[model samples]
Target: MIEVRRFKKRFGSKEVHRGVSFHVEQGECLGLIGGSGSGKSVLLRSLIGLEKADSGSIVIEGQDITQMTERELIGIRKKVAYAFQGGALFDSMTVFDNLAYPLREHTDLKESDIKKKIRDLLFEFGLADSENLFPGSLSGGMQKRVGLARAIILNPDTILYDEPTAGLDPFNTRKISEMILRLKAKKKTGILVTHDMPVAFEVCDRIALLVHGNLDIIAKPKEIQQDALHPISIFAHGDIT
Candidate 1:
């Protein structure tokens, strides 16, 4: 469902990715783990055209997004949803409005239909009562749930999660894991950028390690764990977070 080939990116004199490459099949979640400044989130953003690569290609379902213009990316963004690390909700808008904003802008669904969809999503994410609350008033976990709920409301074929369980407690983390599993059950494709190893191993079918500006290893979770000599397994137990 997704392929990134010979991807390279630079900011000023610093280059973050050099010939980085990977692929994700449909209905699979690939966990991205890396040391600080390895550009995991940058890779996620590049998929939806949030960060344009300097060279190479990012093809989603057959279309190369790296060659597309900003206007052309508007359509691409709908099929690929990004759940930002901090929820990225509007400070002033209520949760309902925050989730409704995308539907209203990109979809032709009526107000009644939008409300129904939002209500169902909130309920499924255990946030039925949060529809009327603002982002500031909710707990860290609830905000993440709302963000995930909003990201999936469009029923996008792919989801890019940037640290979805970064700051949550165990219960909340498990909740997020369960939610991700639910999405997997529905055959949703995803790329999860997370340093939370337990969650990564629990929810991801495969985990890849980003080192020295490239993906040095990609393997099943058990394979990663068994190879203690590998960079990924060595770094897995480190304080990368």
Candidate 2:
């Protein structure tokens, strides 16, 4: 459902993405694993047109987003949702309002309908009681769940997750992992940018290792795990020897 070809991005003298390329098929979750400063998050932002690429194509369902105008991208944004790493919630808004914000802005649904949608999503994400709470009141894991809940509140065709399981305990990490798997079960297309290898292996149908601003390897979890001597595997395992 998403294809990136020969993508390149730069900031001043630094090149963030140098001819990076990858694809995520419909109903497939592709994990993008890379170290800090590898441009994984930037690539995710570029997918939804939040970060414009210097060159190359980012095609979603055959539309080249790189060439689209901001007005034109509004429709694409509805089809592709991004869940930010730090829960990016509006500190002033309650959780219900935060989840309802997208629907209220993007759809013509009535207030009652919007409330229903928010209630359902809260229940789905185990945030039913969190509707009245603010981001500061929640735990790290709860905040992450709320972030994810807001991302899918629109029922987008594709979801881009940036460090979904970051900074969470093992229990919460497992919950987030299971939530991702549940999304996969329902045939959701996703690109997961995470440093959590176990979560990546557990949830991704294919894993893409980004190295030196490019995709160094793209393979199934087992394929990657079995080749411990491979550069990507070694990097993932932190075994430089």
Alpha-carbon TM-score of each model against the true structure:
0.96, 0.96
Clashes of each: 0, 0
Per-residue lDDT tens digits for candidate 2, residues 44-82, read: 999999999999999999899999999999999999989
Q: Estimate, for each residue in 63-92, the C-alpha lDDT of model 1 and write its tens digit.
A: 999999999998888889899888998989
lDDT of each: 0.91, 0.91
Report the Cα lDDT for residue 181, model 1. Answer: 93
Pairs clashing within candidate 1: none
Error of 1 at 135 (Å): 0.8
Report the poorest 10 consecutive residues by lDDT, candidate 2. 232-241
Question: How many residue-pair clashes does candidate 2 contain?
Answer: 0
State model 2's lDDT. 0.91
Tell me the lDDT of model 1 at 149. 86
